[model samples]
Target chain A: MSGEVIRRARGAVAALVLVGLVVAPWVVDDYTTALLARTLALALVGVSVALLTGVAGMPTLGQTAPYAAGAYACAVVGSRVSDVGVVQLVVAAGAGALLAALIVPLVVHARGVIVLMITLAIGELVVVVLGRWRSVTGGTDGLAGVPAVRPFWGLPALASDQGRYLYALVVVATLVGAVLVLLRTRAGLVLRAGRDDETRLRASGHRVAVHLSGAHIAAGAIAGAAGSVLVVAQQYISPADFGFDTSALLLLGVVIGGTASVGGALVGAALVIAVRDWLFGVLPGHAPLVLGALFVATVYLLPTGVNRARSRLSEAAAPQPDPPAAQERATVGEVGR
Target chain B: MTAVAVGTNRIDPYLIPALDGVAYGLLVFVAASGLVLCFGVANILNLAHGLLYAIGGYTAAALLDGGWASLALALAVGVLAAAAAGVLLAGLLTPVATGSHLSQALLTFGVALAGGSLLVAGFGPDDPQVQVPATLEGSVMVAGHRYAAYRLVFIVVAAVLAAALYLVVRRTRAGMLVRAAVDDPEMVACLGVSPARIRAGVLAAAGALAGAAGVLGAPIIGPGTDTADTVLLLSLVVVVLGGLGSMAGTLLAALAIGEIQTLGVALLPAAAPFLLFAAMAAVLAARARGLAVRWRTA
Candidate 1:
């Protein structure tokens, strides 16, 4: 296909997704609508993971830090000030970005396992600080009493579950669209390039660290936004909400959905949240077993994740523009980078 | 090391804690040594390593009788069981043996999560206790402070194991082959040695070591829902700081971290958790590649 055709197709798909999201809350049951909202919020974190791990070629287990940062930011602001929902969300995002900036430089300096461990350590540090700063953070009890979110200037407070879900959908969809646009930019291209060959990208005079830092901060911001949405929707924020398990689950969602693709992240997040919720409803104590089995099976069965399946389906109708060999090379290049 | 004056005014209050830190660090070494070996030989950052450690602890908790004979029996069972679990895990991962580290990590993490829950299911939510033998249950006076005798035994056992591993890796033909395989698996295979078999062997040995640590260290650390996760995190820290696949590096890093943790707690309990992470960040920032050693030669 020609570049024009490909671009048009991509735009059409994005528009369709937006339409689907807009209509989803009305179509689904109340429980599912709430679930969808939670899924989208989680997917925002998945988006961050995809950008950092999938696109920028950095593996981080420390996203929970920014996650908690955003949650607490909104919780603190919302509790103190009344009904400035939009402002709270912005502050939450900024809080995430700020937290990311504090650690990304140190993390970016290291490579491979060193990077992995340092980010993980930073994440643990965030949890410790949150737990210890009881006077400020409310310690293990968590900060509560988050007011209803007024998502926009003209909009009334999102008091109903459906209203909150739609608000979350709007925020998540906008971020998703923004990420898609960002992917087309010079910085985004450099981020992907850095993942493929950092040394070459560096030799070619692209500031790899800067690109990486930007990606990290972007991920943090998205996660922060997600956290703020979660806080507003639940009207509660707790350290347990963004623990290691959440970080792990977010990474798993990114991988299961297909990293390096916005749609994949959304699908992965939705799947994770759905499965967890469904399993809890049906099989209360056995969710971990099933979840673990799913994780192993996903890795074994869909090595490249559900994105590969999506591409395969698309190929049946459209014949993928790139040859199999080129795609294979891309896969090889992307893994373990 | 015990030469510090006993009185409160004599020396650094942290000195005793630091010595205690040494004992704690040795236990860490015992748990992490296997993980480092697995990474060094097989290039697998086994996330289920903590599960194996837990398995060992639980085995001792469930099976061990009271006396010395039972203790020896328990150690043997724990090591063998862990070794078998390692072999099984490696078998499960054989298909993705040459795959990306991400998949390997995910698979192991899956095992940790699921296997951890299974342990709770089988053993109940309560943290399992492994009783120290009567002879080893008492405390010894050290610098006018009483310290658990089991800790000293742990130090001796870990030190001996460390020394033995050094000798084997440095002097033995099998160790040479293992090191060579790590550096260049294909080259070793070209010379008619099966790197896969060697990796399996190393993984089993690592599991056994982890099991031994779990059985012996259970009295101190114990097994619980979060034990595997916590131990996995700490062990990974030790491996990263020590340099992947380097035993001596693991030992040094473990000892240093042990002291930092114990002493940090002694000084400021609230900040203790952050101290290790802070130290790790500082180390990684200063030495971007980590304190990794040359694979084949080192």
Candidate 2:
């Protein structure tokens, strides 16, 4: 229960998750692999949300703006080229990051309800563009036929289903690892400080608004990157896919997974997707209502996250332990909120 | 969306219905009253406001089909339905959303989403139409064009409604409680009046207003997805611009927005939706001049 052990445990779990993504396609069926690709895409968005809500305390409800941006970015690019997935991904992520910067200035000064309303406005604006601007966006029909990230110079082919799944897994793993690294840096610590008490940190001599804005951009980039992968995998990007519902779903997943950890985001994505997918198969058309029920339950029962359930069960099952104050201290720090 | 040519010498068919947009605006005021009331009192953004609007439309449509004698009877049904829904939501969901707008946002957002989907599942996605009531069905020629007479009647009714609201809020004890709560919660709470019970009354009244708007307007405008969206956006613009609890501001802003929206679409068809956001942006930017948002726990 010591802080050092907890930190080490988290690092180990993250590493294990990374490895599992790499080896997953080999063990699971192609269907599950593809499902996992979807989960990874969602996890990427959830991670961005984690950064904003968990790291910066800015609970942005409408990430579908950048998620759709990333998807549309890829859609725009892949319509022109069949290769250079890296360039497409980079472009999508950059566009998402740019949008975050553009939208942040007016609302960054406000918190809580104002922040939510502005984000909701931004989302509505995006939906209108996607719906009304028919010429470029295909209107409600959505962008289709997005080619997968093709093989680059000297890289192995990503043409098969398994290959494509691995390709997605690799992208999420690398991106999540990058997010982890960014959070460990001074900027990350500052992001956390801003999340908890920006006023005090402002008093301690830091540009709080700037840090908050930077966090927004960073989180947006992560989401956009996820959207890039999603578009390529689904080979479609409709306005409905980027609606407020999807945004809410992303938020729900992040909350369910426990918003503070990269692993939590992934777990949230996995559980949410798995539950919906399974329930849909079992009950046919009753998924929406059931999913709504699940959302309410998750927020109530595992409010901190499903990890609390897991951690509690594990602790209960384990042998008795001596006091681990150091372990507790590290966890307290890592838990953020 | 070309502007209604002010200096026009020619008679156009669509031009007359355009003028009726004013009377239509007043009807919207009557309907939006409930939303403004609930929002001001509860600090709860009822995303399902449009659903109540839809319920009103459907109820009116049903009553009109069943050959109701007067608009009054149809309005009553719609109002009752909305009141019931308000009561249901207050009882079932308010506990979860008691103190956090985030939680309220999530719950109500879910309700709206599910409500929309459920309606889609139940009624299908096609726009629903109702026959205009017999008494107000015909048109009167004005400015060399014919405009629906019911629109004028709606304006008269709306004026009466607005007058009644002013009297009730200023003279009634419940109105006193609401004004007290809006101005200063501590004073309201200290006065030994139950803000919760008062909110329930305001919410019920608001729901009825939304329902009335829905039912009455559905025949004239038609009820569907677009109707719901327009109602939600218009309410937000009105509520925010009015500064939450200011009834006078709500009335002023609603009428102004109605003209702007009707005229904006008439004037610049291509930039229709942007004009809305333009107005919102203007209001939002002007927040620097002491446009303070007081957040009360929903």
Candidate 3:
């Protein structure tokens, strides 16, 4: 129950999850492998959601806009320009970053629920454009027959479900690792500070909006890269794939994972999306019903998130004189009041 | 002279869409007013507001049979049903009332998702047809363009509802209490009226408004799988654009949105989808400072 022991346990659990992911494609059936690949792509998007929602003090449902931009861009470039996964990823990331940059002005000043609403609108608008822009996007039918992607030059193109799953896993791990490293930097500290108290950060002469805008672009790039992986995994892209439901589910996944933890976001999002895909496969029309129930239960039971609950347990066992994290959480809870 | 003539010709084809915008805007106003009140007074962002509206839409679809009596029955049933749903939501929200907006959103969104699926399960997955009253089902000539009579009736109904709401909020003791609660819940609580009751009452009223909009607007928006999302998004846009609490601002924002959705689409079909959000982002970004101040104070 000590903090050190809790950290070690978390490390061990992460390693076990990684090992499981690495071996999953080989053990699972092709359908499950494909599903896992899709979940990986979505989980990566969840990391970006957490980056903004947890790290930067902005809860967004519009990451899908940049995600879709990255996806369609990757799909287009994959078909016409290159099939190399790296090239597609760069294009997708650039597309996503560009879209995020454009939207920075709209969201930078907004806080709390206003950001959520604005992002929700932005996300819906992207879907609308995707559904209507048939000439390039193929309308609601989405782009199909996206060429297979090679992980690198001279590498064989992904052909089987297992191959695609491994490709997605590797990409997700690399991007997630990058995000983890990035969050340990000064930029992350500033973002967390701003989240805790923007007024104090501003008084300290920090350009809070600039840091947020940077975080927004970085998250967009990450989501966009994930979109490329999604195209690679599914080999088809459509507006329905990035609908409001996807954004909502991703947000819930972040909440479940602990909004402030990147690893938690990854796992939580994957778990949520995986469950949804599985439920749809097994239960057909009742997926939303179950997922909705899960969301409500998550809110009620895991008010702070799965990660936070564990930390709280550890803290309770080894009580601290004054926990800054707990105090920060208290401030976060006061948002929108 | 030639340019002006071309402009007139161009505008001729969009007259109906322009009128449709007015009707659409009014519906959005009705739906969003409830959201404004809930957020403004109760400070609870009810994501299930759309579900409440859908309840009304489904009720209208189920009860209306193109008869006057059916219309009256649908309105009554829809309002009552949606009001009850709102009260249920208030009960559900009781625990999370003091939680962050995220928790409240998650809870309400869950209710919306669960309630939406339940409605679908009960009503079937397909978009159900809604029959309006026989007399109002027909089209009427307006400036030489034939328009749906049902849509025209929205203008009158919405205007009356808006005026009544304005009066109630401005003149009645309950209205003063609601305003006082928004400004200072502690002060309102000190006066002996439970803030919880006010919260529940506000949600119920909001639900009734949404239900009425849903039932009346059913012929246009319809009860379907996508209805809840569409209404929720539009109402959210209206509420945000209108700056949350002010009814007049909400009405204006709704009207602008209706025009953009209808007339803007007609004028620029190629750029139709990007129009609404683009305008929203532009307006919000332009007024960011004002909005931040307003949000802080609100």
Candidate 4:
């Protein structure tokens, strides 16, 4: 297929998915609607993971730190301060950004697996804090009965499951659209350039660290906003929601989605988390086993990712002097060493 | 006289935890050594290193029965079992030998998740009991404080193991080859030694070390659903803080971590949870800054 044709097809599919999501609550039961809302929140996190792992060349398992920060912040704000959705979201994003800013020094200079380990440590520490800080976070049990959120100041609070699901869907869509727009800007170009060749970008006087810090903070903000959506969707939040497993699964989902594609990340994360939730309901003890096996299979079957493999097939027809993908793989291999 | 006694009493409360820290630190060192070797020599992250440790832990839990013969048998079985698993991981990693760390991590993490659940299924979901030899199961007096004999045994065992590892790495021809490979794999390959075999050998040796640690440290850390994650996190912390490859650095980092977890927690209970990662982030950022400075000057 030609590039134009593939792009058109993808647009059509995305449109179909949007329409389907809009009507999903009506088609499915309340339980399924609630689950989809939760999935949407997680899928947004997946987008942030892609922003760091793919675009910024910093594969992180620590986005959850900001995510948890946003969540707990939203929960606290929603209960004591304001029950307004927009207010909670802004606070959550600020909270997430603040946490990301705090850890920027720890992660900004690291690359490859080193970034991963540091982020993993940060995420674990956040979870530990959440588990221990009983007065604020309600400890391991999490904050339950978070007040219902009004989408706007004058609007009625979301009461029904479908209402909450629709609210989450709108929030996710708006944020995802914002991210897509952000990526089209010069800032995104610099991030991609830095990811491909940091030394060259630095030599060009791009101020690579500043751009990376911006991207990191932005991703954190997006993840934090997702945390507010999560608070609205479930009306409960806990450290369990932001465990290492969630981060791992989100990273895997982003990979499956084609690491650099925001849309792919959303779909990929939703599918993975949905599968996990479904497996828990159906197989009980066998969720990790099946999901793990799927992860291993995905690595072998779609090494580049679902989106990249499809594009690579089309790009194969016109042979170039050098493929950037191959170069990327080589550089990644070197970085690992 | 009163002031002197008061000071002694204040210091006396922390004596056992300080001793416990040494034992815990040594166990972490033993477990983390395998990770250091895998990443340093083989260039494989081996995220499943914790699962390998858990294999030995489960073996110890199943086999040890509070007898000397049981202890010997458990060590043998644990070492063999974990080494076999390591060899299996080597086989699995062979295909991804030249892949990115992300791919390697995905594969190994998959194996860890699947393998961890399988172990849980086989061993049952609850934490399993581990039996130490009858003589070592009792407490030993140390600095006027009674400490668990099993934990005390770790100090001696770990010292002997560390010495053996040091000698092997510094003295043996195989160690020379391994170090040579790390410095320049292409040159080592040019010399006609099979790098693949060396990779396999390193993984097997790493597994044996982790297995032995698991079996011996089982009485302290125990076998449970969370054992793999806990051990993996600590080992990664040690590896990162130790500057990735140096054994002496790894040992010191592990000891620091051990004290922080035990003694630091005791000293500042409110800040206990933040101590380890705070220290790690601080050390890593400082090193990165130092490297940036060096790079600029050079």
TM-score of chain B of each: 0.91, 0.86, 0.96, 0.95
Q: For model 2, what is the alpha-carbon lDDT of residue B135?
A: 60
lDDT of all predictions, in order shown?
A: 0.76, 0.68, 0.85, 0.83
Per-model TM values vs. the true structure: 0.88, 0.83, 0.93, 0.93
Candidate 1 wrong stretches, greater than 4 Å: A1-17, A26-30, A81-83, A111-114, A152-156, A306-337, B1-16, B289-298
Question: What DockQ does each prediction reach against the true complex?
Answer: 0.38, 0.16, 0.50, 0.42
Compared with the true structure, model 3 gives a TM-score of 0.93
- Predicted model with the maximum DockQ: 3
Q: Is the docking of candidate 2 incorrect, acceptable, medium or high quality?
A: incorrect
How many residue pairs clash (N, CA or C atoms closer than 3 angstroms) in each of the candidate models, in the order given?
0, 12, 0, 0
- Compared with the true structure, model 1 gives a TM-score of 0.88
Q: Which RMSD values do the candidates have, in order?
A: 5.8, 7.9, 4.6, 4.5
Model 3 chain B worst lDDT window (10 residues): B95-104
Q: Is the docking of candidate 4 incorrect, acceptable, medium or high quality?
A: acceptable
Quality of candidate 3's docking, in CAPRI categories?
medium
TM-score comparison, 1 vs 4, better candidate: 4
Chain B fold agreement for model 1, TM-score: 0.91
Q: Candidate 1 on A129-224: residue-level lDDT in tens?
A: 787778778988998877788877887888888899888887887888899898999878887776655555667888777887888898899889
Worst 10 residues of 4 chain A by lDDT: A312-321
Model 4 residue A105 distance off true place after TM-score fit, in angstroms: 0.9
**Candidate 2: C-alpha lDDT:** 0.68
Model 4: per-residue Cα lDDT over B132-243, one tens digit each: 8888878888888888888887889988998898889889998888878766666787899887898889899889999999999998789899898889889988987887
